[model samples]
Target: MSGMVTSAHAPRRDETERADGSPVTIGALVPLSRPGWAEAGRHLLAGLELAVGEVNDAGGIGGRPLELVVRDTAADPQRAAAAVDELAGLGVAALAGEYHSVVARAAAARADALGLPFLCSSAVIDALTERPTHRVARIAPAQSHGWRTYADFLLGAGHRRIAVAAQPSVYWASGTRILRDHLAARGASIAELDMTEQPATAVCDALAEQGATALLLLVGHPEPAVSIVRSVRQDPRLADVVIGAPAGQPEFAEWAGALGASGAGIPFLRYLPERLGPLGARVGTALRERLGQPPSFVAFEGYDTVAVLAAVLRDHGTDRARVAASWPHVAVEGTRGKIRFSRTPGTGVWQWAWPPVQVVDRDPAEPARFRILHTG
Candidate 1:
């Protein structure tokens, strides 16, 4: 009887618990407005919310469920910094969100100073990961890679004499410069058109006068693209010239028609939200179902950003140190492509960027298709 009591009295097992004996809560800062960011924010929120739900369902972190606290940055760096500061105050294990490069820079510094592992979800500017600051990990590829692909497409097609139209933002300026430099290296003549001062008509006319046969548009806004196309079509000499864009935003289709069908026949690169794998699709569907729409490339970053952070959280168990140390492996298959940060110091910004170059050519009986001109 004593032997039987000893066998039955074996110490009961104890469940694992966190240092504070609490569940992990993550924080996210995203721009819900500022054109092209709202839909993306919703998609990312859905992706994150769904993932968190699943994580909790599987038995929350350290036997405690997960929670997320969210904030909006509005695409302004100052506002983003404030948002980051606010999220930081929540004592979250990790922080995520903020896609604009400038905003990322500020938020990254804040996260680093606070020793928070910052997962930059969708900002594609090369400035985020290029710093020695090393406080941030990105799940988005650099825009330079995309620009390189654009240059290669132009060069391989034997298209010389290129005209570029760009907005004044650093994102556009930097990307344009990268593409321009690459094109020049490959023996392609370039004409830079500053959209700040000159209208699209003036810029197109100038390019036409300069004997430009192909126009490579770098402007993020679709307005300039449509305007340029209208001008080119009006000038019979420039009408048949090859026109290419990095990615035509879907939200601009009506604007494309408003500007005229000339650009409707041209080709542009498009951000494909559906190609980002299961995690991306789930988030995208959630956003559409909940918000009545899907997100753009920027917002897609939000879903990817949250996914990467959640993976880190699952592995590290609420340790900021472990999360930062393991960031190079936080692979996020976003709408663009599989993304993660490079541990190598002083590398260019963006951990992964998979943007496809596409042409928006009009069909006689069908709608415009964003055909893949080349995959970067």
Candidate 2:
């Protein structure tokens, strides 16, 4: 567990000259073995690899190649903590790349205990960075940011009455709460339904009966979200209801497309659409060449995390403390837009103040032709 799991692309590091001449190693804790998230983890790793390759191609940080030490968390909190410990034991300078909020929480604690710099890539739970830590930062926008934006989009679309079918996970629950609060403040009527207990058909019927104009599917996992979408689409009475989800954007398009005509026009929030900026276009091109698909939001986060970390390493050396201290002042151009960190009251730690996001609808006829309805 104290040894590095080297990839073929990673440069070899001399053990004797590790202090000054070895490759700078960063630990990546991702859910590589998780059932539903395996493919997502691969995409994240691909992004990390692309960034590392780019950095190395550009002469790396101070002439030392950047290398990744990856571990599979399986989306399990205990496994994530253990992975952090393992990476720390292997002497990684910093830690990054986690998709699940629960795993990020445990990994953050372990990273703090080890005094290692941790830059969360995509975990969006508000409490992940709520407390000040000497070495924790996040590149992803907070849940409130996404939820508030979603609420604004709903209100702007003239959706006065909205129904929310949400899973009970912290990711979904927190998002639901934020949406509810924001919509309530804007005088929009809200109906909340638990997706775990209630049948999707019953929920769809209830929303239709209540004259709901939109259905916000807050299910965190992709499979369940697809199931709900299928169920909702089965009812002809609910055909006019605008369906939306905060998680699983472009990836869910394929699952939605599996429903044939039923999934044609469902909308979802995407954190970093490929059409955002020049950097996004570059990332998209690289991803398509490498993975044969456009980059996912998680992939964008992975690339940005490594890109920012490389910049920090270039300026601050590989010292974890220095890198952590410099994070608050670090700003780099990300795939979606400019990446910057700021201390927020909600998450009383340095985190990406605002990351670009967009609302995109699925196009069953052409999954690649997903339409962007709103940008933020």
Candidate 3:
């Protein structure tokens, strides 16, 4: 019930769900809840399950269909490793989805050791591709990339002095570095602030002292990022400085509110393929019917991850090595856009899923206010 009827094709049943309910299936593992992320984890799982249903309804991969084996990683490296091993023991063709960079790395290593393809939908740290053991494909733009894009936007908007803030994670570090480099290359000056462990007040004070025209925030966590923005908003000199984000957060609007900031003159970058939405929405509907709601970003990623593997399987067959090798060319419509890999691993850039930038020049809630800055 949770699948797509491609406009070009009719809805069909997957071979996996025969009257007897047996078929070639795969497993999807996601970060289960740690002490703090129970709600987010559940949402991600729901999205993945929704994707599985849609794929099955569309007659499943090569007509064989798939069964999803679900596992919870608890967002811990040790636990994630154990869960992947468990899935491997079950002989799943491929695996997808992890939020933590370290946990994703461990999963990728295991997939490679076991000769399985791993598609990372959210992990954007540049180092994930450095693993020699696992074959991996990433759907999100690398951390450095989103930052560079934001820098370009700010420079174009006549902002020369910028302030940068980021969390301590691998993704945030790389993103902040890239923004610095881009600004320097353009002969623009930027004051950098690493919020790795600093209090929000200190960060805001640092940005205020810089007297920058804008803030380029790459803080990994939305809540703290919001806090930083709010603190800055209280400082008259800092409030007018435009804020930019490359990492997509669902609470971006709420964070803006907490900071008394508006998306006006703010820009956010996304790396998902363009046509991914219609398909993703269909999957969400089907998932809601059975699982009560679509999964969170994590679960949708898992579904996309499996879909990519299934596409490769259809094109290449059951050979795991071939599927890994063919990743650079294996393209599929995802929730964000058409997803594919770069021939050069770890480019920190994606060839597909680039959307035109939009300027938040007014209240973010205003309709048609998102004037296109660029188009695919």
Number of clashes recorded per candidate: 13, 0, 19
- Stretches of candidate 1 off by over 4 Å are 1-23, 35-46, 220-226, 233-235, 247-266, 269-300, 329-340, 344-365
Please give the range of 10 consecutive residues that has the lowest summed lDDT in model 2.
Answer: 8-17
Per lDDT, the best of the predicted structures is 2
| Candidate 1 lDDT score at position 116 | 75
- TM per prediction: 0.78, 0.90, 0.76
Across 66-124, the per-residue lDDT of candidate 3 in tens digits comes to: 55666667767677777767766655566666666667777777776777677766665
1 versus 2: better lDDT goes to: 2
Winner on TM-score between 1 and 3 is 1
The sequence of per-residue lDDT tens digits that candidate 1 reaches over residues 222-297 is 4666667667778777865777766444333454446544545455444453245766676667656655543445
Kindly give the stretch of ten consecutive residues in candidate 3 with the minimal lDDT sum: 4-13
In model 3, where do residues sit more than 4 Å from their true spots? 1-23, 32-47, 131-134, 220-222, 250-266, 272-303, 333-338, 345-362, 365-376
Runs in model 2 with CA error above 4 Å?
1-20, 250-257, 273-276
Please provide, for model 2 over 67-146, each residue's C-alpha lDDT reduced to its tens digit, 9 standing for 90 to 100. Answer: 88888888898888988877777667788898888788889988888888899998888888436775888988888887
Clash number for model 3? 19
